[model samples]
Target: MVTDEDKVFKALADASRRQLLDKLRKKNGLTLGELCADHAMSRQAVTKHLVLLEAANLVVTVKQGREKLHYLNPVPINEIYMCWIGQFEQKRLQALHNLKQSLKENDHEQ
Candidate 1:
């Protein structure tokens, strides 16, 4: 079944979309025009990417005055980490801790 994590992963598959996320991360709130300012992609292309990002819940928009301000919603990414990467991270930390203890024991024996 396709879940929200699937949507976020799909949206993040494109390099352009990743770049857009990076821009938003650097500056949390920006208008569409501001996001497209230094980018080489067309405004329409950027708009499409933003739409995908919003659909994936990675980006959120708020209408402020006449402008739609876009902001990065990091919750989805955090969820991805907690559900995916975090599992392996705990094992890796435990292994590192064991290695550190072994090294300390070896030093004491010398």
Candidate 2:
């Protein structure tokens, strides 16, 4: 099965592709021309990056008349955060809380 992590990792594998995602995240929906303007690469290069992102389901394109507008699909990224960072954050917060309590106890002993 193609998991959410698989999609996220694939989408993030290329620097240009990640930059494209960042651009879409900021703008939400943008035309191809607007996305191309931010990069030194050719329009073709940007299109290629968009294709990979589309394959990963990280981006979705819609026809807005003659122009195809691209939008970031954030579900996969949210899944990654929930599965990965969410767990780590809980553990980190617990550890920090424990340390704070330990420090308070040490102060009490002094």
Candidate 3:
């Protein structure tokens, strides 16, 4: 019953994983050692989290010479916003625009 988007949401639900994503966002193309430098969790724990993040397509890796550099892939998150949040936001924004137009018309008639 669960979809890939569900997997993305599930991965993002964890604070540790979110922290990893935040770090990548601030500075992309970081190696595993660089990622592990400022974290309370063990390196193995971070590795596990990275696996899940990659499954969700939230993080991508590139082989740069001897190292595998990790980078944040924001496409999944943007898809989530467009598929979920943006639809609801559009309706609310339209209502606000309509209200503003009505108020403008009322002022013009006064």
- Give the top-scoring candidate (TM-score): 1
Superposed by TM-score, candidate 3 places the C-alpha of residue 10 at a distance from the truth, in angstroms, of 1.1
Give each prediction's root-mean-square deviation over alpha carbons: 8.6, 8.8, 9.4
Collision pairs in model 2? none
lDDT of 3 at 15: 100
Q: Give lDDT tens digits, candidate 2, residues 1-110.
A: 44546756877988989888889878888999999995899999898888878878899899988999999998888887787678758888889989999999999999
Candidate 1 segments whose C-alpha is farther than 4 A from its true place? 1-3, 87-110
For model 3, residues 1-110, the per-residue Cα lDDT tens digits are 22388889899999999999999999999999999997999999999999999999899999999998999999988987787678768889889989999999999999
Candidate 1 clash total?
0
Model 3 lDDT at residue 32: 95
Cα error of candidate 3 at position 9, Å: 0.9
Rank by TM-score (best first):
1, 3, 2
In model 3, pairs of residues that clash are: none
